[model samples]
Target: MEHDRTRTRAWVLHPEIKSDEQRRVPEPALEEAVALAAALPDLDVVGSEVVRLQRAQAGLLFGSGKIEELGERFHENEVELVLIDGPVTPVQQRNLEKAWKVKILDRTGLILEIFSDRARTREGVLQVEMAALSYQRTRLVRAWTHLERQRGGLGFVGGPGETQIEADRRAIDEQLVRLRRQLQKVVKTRTLHRAARAKVPYPIVALVGYTNAGKSTLFNGLTGAKVMARDMLFATLDPTMRRVELPDGPEVILSDTVGFISNLPTELVAAFRATLEEVLGADLVVHLRDISHEETEAQAQDVETILTSLGVEDDRPRLEVWNKIDLLSSEDRQATLARAERDPAIFAISAVTGEGIAPLLSEIATILQGARHESTLSLTFAEGQKRAWLFRQEVVRSEEQTEDGFEITVLWTDKQAARFAAL
Candidate 1:
């Protein structure tokens, strides 16, 4: 819709197409769509519904009768925008806008809008621009369907044989090319920064989860950085990193990443990948979950699926954070804590109340410290290089001189141990 001072009244529709092989439970899905609508700055969501259908129509998506009925409702409410919480074809979008007499946005467009509003960094803005351009490029299809088609002609004949669609596509392509170049420069700068961070000995722990899953809150609690920890979806679009020295643990760089969602737009999946590169390079990944949400399990599965799609290896070190336990009932909280305690990889914590944080931090420290048990090393007197290296690394706990060598005890991280081995 129009970006102005006045709010755009919007309606949300989640189509539950029965013919589709994968179907989300409609009610929560509808709620999520409404939340997505609410995420935009100028959109005021007035009403929402879960529309059940045997199948989606190819041209208009909804049936004629249904369209007319919805049109009447829109007229009654003065709805300026209709947000369909699914993939709407360009043809269907055009036809529905004609029938409903209002602007229509599918799931992708709405997400793109929210991201556009939330992006603060220059690189983030460029990425969003590129993604929105790509989406608009695809939508160029049906808008020019009614334009005059060019027939066979020479370079100077028949008005150069160029149709409106081709011109529009060409303009969008040019815009995308320029945006890509700008984005590459920004990315290169970030790569240089990442390289500098790489030289530091601190390990990186990345926070990743579904939108509004308390990742930002946990990140703030751990690092003491005042990141935007709002309840809104896609609240944090750009990555924020901070150094944290854990209690009785090694120092680490904590990275807060943009949250994942179900059915993310493919364009964004590619465009925003650069922002998530921190996750790929992190030494420890913490998958935070809103354990209090009704559809928590489903949301966790969606996050897992996205992580796999992003090529996060199965062998990567990861921890499951069951956050927001303060929102749970006392009994459920106890049960969750008990369950988490049973699994070393799972931690139940309330980032708001700071409950269970000590244990989680201790665990992170334990993991970052590599093998907890100290290793004994036999170094001959002639092996002064290795002996001096151990002392320089400050991992030596104790040393004893024997007849021909020295016996040393050391505590070190896996990375340090590996470096020593390489030397």
Candidate 2:
């Protein structure tokens, strides 16, 4: 991402609350938060830190002393925005902003901003706006001082539901209803398009993995398409599909989708369900992992958790792809390749270098070939295109040159036969 205008001077803080049972390691969590901040083009990350504490305060999030210390640092640096790497309540946000005199954004808020900026498709844009609206709806807590005043109800007895807050909630609900209707029309069109593709006989392979795990690189390498592949996180936000014919393998529609991260916001998880339906309907799920990262196992686990949450069955056909072997040291690279060789399901490769790709494609071909059937057909010499296509598909079992034209025995799928008949 590139930006020419002025940027927001931001600082990142990963709150390591020890009392939280599901807290991630603060060091990498902070690292990922900084990366997430960097993903947005208009945020100039000025500083970042791991703020460790025994527990979180209900109203202030951090104790007064530490808050004062952080306030002084932000003042000195002129930090315009503060991004908390964990969840922060509306009260906590209001207090922290007042104390530090800077805008406050939690992990969920930051992700929404990135998605808003990167969404390309119509459905993608609608989903991000809906997610952002949902997030803002929660943030409207006591953050709005005027909302505390009574609106139309009795002064003493009936007070809870009669406030400006209720009015704001109604507005958001109305907008959500409008967006949902528009999204329903878009989704219906997409479903029709998907149904048309279903009759084409090509399988769909979905690529899923942690953010910045080199999925787009592998996608470009396989399809020869100019997809945006960057080191930054969430570079590819919408689902990108391309037709790719593997070496001696079936032709497949490869889908590169939005990256998954640890502790994804619930709003986004629901919003992105429609975008990730490709993975649910896929014939094969290819999980790409960045093997060189120190926290590779933890990252892979996060992807698995998201997959399970999406209701992907445990027995679904899948292949674990360990990528970026070239980034590893010589000794580690050898060991990684050795492990991959032992596990037939895992492939170690560098998508950049095109190393270890042939074997992986061969495996995919082997798996898809299970549906193939053998057939004997006679083709006239005049039908040269048909003869050439059979050999190109690598489905030709045998051939004999006859006086009429040629006799060929083929092992192929129903789709292949349909294509041949059309040719």
Candidate 3:
């Protein structure tokens, strides 16, 4: 027998956005939610509306009358699920569900569900599950009513009318420990691979941008690696790193990280730290922007905001690459070019047509070479390890093996030279 389908009613509760900033809040999220609701196989989205809640009552979220009206509507319309467009606190979520007598899901929950549905890799699944579990731990009370129920196995179990908060916390803590252990293994393996790459010391360039900004296309164009490239939000969740060569005699490792989005969940940011380490350690950061996007400047600012949070804003050399030039008219293209010329660090290019990549790479090569430090240093033959370390870390200019010692002349970063000097 087929299970009964639940009627899902969704409404957007956007935090007061002025008309000016409405463009920043893409309609794709709502559209995606509608599509997801339709494909759920269990729920039907019957209606939706945008409600503006007052800031003071933001805790309860909806006003008392609004809550009563919505609850009545739920009863009248036979709504079994309520989808909220903003974050809902644990207490508020529980209270809302009790009032409406329906399952409630916040914006984070919806996004998590989408990610769960789309995740294909084992690592991606694990990361998403970890984030979901973290979120669920806070709202366990919403899922169960018999908090007074006690089990035989444990002295710590809740008794008569007691909340399951403690037990839920304990359970979540245990899972967190396990997840950390598993993620640690992944981190260790990634570290080993990174260390191995250090022996060859190819310059690394990383691409960072807002979601669906054509990073994967540029990556495929540059490296000839086929990764999933789609014109959808969060199309590529897993970071893909590939080897690329610039014509100016430098081999590079180019990495494309998961795209950033406005108001990305904090849990997601924390869970994906390992994946973003590639950006943190890169020699050059190519900040890709979608020139065709209507909110292109704002999108660029959002990427910079996230990068700043990652502590990469000031230290790393960056190239602002405005992509999708093919979509622009000749006048707009010339305007973009003129803007790029005014900013020495920015370049405009069409990743689709492969135009302007050559100059961008050449500029990057120059920056990478400038990052190297040229210095004269002396080392004893017995310190073969240090000599090898220098070779492993940087391009060695010259080396001589003598009866007493090995003499080397090298170009390296000042940081690396300091490391050699300390030895």
Candidate 4:
């Protein structure tokens, strides 16, 4: 197609070959992608169609005949970009772009692009760039725009061909190492801050949910912070910590983190682990859900899967928050609420209207207390250092001194309890 480089059209292609599966791609996922794309300010989606291609041409991705047909269609429709809803090998991406004479983005590449566009914070941007560079290290051949060449590192092999590929890989490896080190520094700093907070030991409540499931909105509603609560995927990429007061007059840090998605890229999960450590270290995890969506159950499953993958499955206190209840029909909402009542951890509420949210916060305050360990400690008055240590290490509600030893009652987190027991 002869469109301007800035003016591009997108086509979502789903290859349906001879397979046991009924459909090459699920219709709902495609519809979701289209809806997501329509929400984007840039990049117009001109056409979308499904096609069947020979499995024998898997390496090049599409048969030569199909390539010619797609090329003709693109030309006729003035389409400039082809968005494939499946993974495309670097060779396949290059071959298809060459044959079709248009820019091509596979599912992974398009997702990376979306993340690259959405990321705002320094850490978030770095994580996305790291993923992009890792993905680009392999596709060094096809990504070469002449303009980018002028800027350097243009193609799969910028200047030295395959040698450039090795160099790019090495560069990406170094960058990843650096990023990890930087994130580790951040982690250490956070740990120190958490240690300082441990002197008071207010409970921490973490919000974790599927992308666009209204976590940020709920967090803002609870904390009264304008933390960019937009209705977009990964709107809150950076973790935001805010103090929220409960009905019992106790306040806690409410952390809002990056949203989870189905088939979330493993590389991203690993890259963003440092940020997710807040969730792992939280006193309680609030799993938000868009109760109105048809895929609410599936989305809940996806959130749990991601959390389990992150290794927070066992013993972490969790609460289910069925958000967006206002979007559901009255009957459906009532039925869902009835079902939710049967689950011990589940609560249905609209984050917008604050329905059922006060009780949820009260429950959180109650659960936060249960997450701690109550212990009575014995220490000598001579061991004032130990008393100071106990104060520093555990959340002591009261203390008393004895000739034999000083007995102090403390509420500790799991880790702190372990430390106190060891001492």
Highest-lDDT candidate? 2
List the candidates ranked by TM-score, beginning with the highest. 1, 2, 4, 3
lDDT of model 1, residue 112: 91
Q: Write the per-residue lDDT of candidate 4 for residues 1-423, one digit (tens) a residue.
A: 355567557777766666525443466567656655554557788887667654636567777777888889898887778888767788888888878888888777777777777677666777788788778777876355444334344565445334444566677888878977876676667677776665555678889988889998999898899998787776777789988778884678899998777765566666667567778768889989898887878888888887887889667788888989899998998998998899878999999999999889888988876566677878876877768877665377688878798888887877777765666
Reference-based TM-score of each model: 0.84, 0.83, 0.75, 0.79
RMSD (Å) of each candidate, 1 decimal: 6.8, 9.3, 5.5, 5.6
lDDT (Cα, tens digit) per residue for candidate 2, span 86-139: 999999999999899999999999999989988999999999989998888988
lDDT sort, best first: 2, 1, 4, 3
Cα lDDT tens digits for candidate 1, 68-161 = 9999999988899999999999999999999989999999999999999989899999989989999998898745444366544466632576
Better TM-score candidate (2, 3): 2
The CA lDDT of each predicted structure is 0.87, 0.88, 0.74, 0.76
Q: Which residue pairs show collisions in model 2?
A: none
Better of 1 and 4 by lDDT: 1
Candidate 2 lDDT score at position 147: 45
Better of 3 and 4 by TM-score: 4
Model 2 clash count equals 0
After superposing all C-alphas onto the true structure, candidate 1 shows an RMSD in angstroms of 6.8
Residue 82 of model 4 has an lDDT of 87
